[model samples]
Target chain A: MNKSIFYHAGCTVCVSAEHDIVKLVGSENVTIINIGEQKSKISEAENSGVVSVPALVRPNGNVLHINFGAAISDLK
Target chain B: MNKSIFYHAGCTVCVSAEHDIVKLVGSENVTIINIGEQKSKISEAENSGVVSVPALVRPNGNVLHINFGAAISDLK
Candidate 1:
């Protein structure tokens, strides 16, 4: 699947999270779009309908918002 | 305005971005929806049409997608 990940220091975890997925999809398969410190990304994010930072996207335009907490993963 | 943030390890940076906004809005004002490892969240994100993790959502149902790199911010 065509993929893209976004990350930044404002949210370091977001950066890391994006990295993990990027790794899973692999550099060749993923279209990495790093926002870094771009405020425009904020607007882009909004225009794209992203509620938060560090978003995982498929070319099909499907998206899932992620929140990492022990509640779900801790069980594992 | 009412606000929400969704994040996870699959995209940790998304998590952090959510946190920062959460802080800005304050716990009392925000409705924290922690997806953790619950697969349902993934579906929720899709149902919501997030198109990415760490989505910043307004009560109005508006969303923003974040990607970090600096191409946009670096200019600033």
Candidate 2:
């Protein structure tokens, strides 16, 4: 499963979601990308329709906004 | 040393600074506060004259903005 979490440094929600995601999926299976560190990925995140940080890109190419209930639920 | 790092999730700079801080002071010595998770701390962070995320509050009650070169230098 190709799972990547695109996040920034100072987003509290993102950190929470990251903890949950890492717990559920195991840290080894996940790729945590700091958007600021990877400047090139900003456009890629934008292309995926992510206007905010803490977006999770699933294997199916669907992006989940971590703040949304649906996204958090989906993680479970 | 009572060192606390006030940070939010999704901030790339904070993550980098956090790594540096943990390396310098050891993770056990520093407290990483996700300002989003700890809502009450937001006001405290603001009260410390921090207008942005990733501010570090030292034991002396002085707050350091992580984006500033001086802050990073001080960490070293």
Candidate 3:
């Protein structure tokens, strides 16, 4: 199975979003690229059209920007 | 005056912390090493004893972990 790419920046919101995405799609089904930890992934993330952290890139290369406000609210 | 090194990971909290620090200490008084933008700085950050992002390294080599909660709240 093709794994989706999850662009993370190691921020609170991104970490929370990761948990939600991983829960939505099994951990094994996604590959996390922490741009904050690995700068090399910044370009890759940009190439994938990620303008911000907590973004999801589907197998087919579709990028979805996660909403930090929504994610934070869900944490409560 | 020696410049303080600010270790950043390009995360929301770190970004906000940077602003506060820069405001507290003039930008010229600090040097920001964006670990998220430069992978090479990871080791440098670790050597400075930065356990997390938004850390400040004094000229004397002391590390201070900025409180993310405080930084975030201050953003409001």
Instruction: List interface RMSDs for the candidates, in order.
Output: 12.6, 15.0, 16.2
RMSD in angstroms between candidate 2 and the native structure over all alpha carbons: 13.9
The residue-by-residue lDDT of candidate 1 on B1-75, one tens digit each, is 544443333345656555554443456655555444455565665566565454544455544444431111112
DockQ of each model vs. true complex: 0.03, 0.02, 0.02
What lDDT, from 0 to 1, does candidate 3 have?
0.66
For model 1, the superposed segments whose C-alpha errors exceed 4 Å read A7-10, A68-76, B1-76
- Arrange candidates by DockQ, highest first: which order? 1, 2, 3
lDDT-wise, the better of 2 and 3 is 3
lDDT of each: 0.46, 0.54, 0.66
Pairwise TM-score winner, candidates 1 and 3:
3
Per-model fnat list: 0.00, 0.00, 0.00
Q: Which stretches of candidate 3 lie over 4 Å from their true place?
A: A69-76, B1-76
Model 1 residue A1 lDDT score? 46
lDDT of 2 by residue, A1-76 (tens): 6555545444555666566545434587568876655666677667766666566565555554444222222221
Per-residue lDDT tens digits of candidate 3, residues A7-58? 7777877786677656545698789987776877677778777776677777
Candidate 3, residues B1-76, lDDT tens digits: the string is 4788887777777786677556545698789987776877777777777766677777766565653322321222
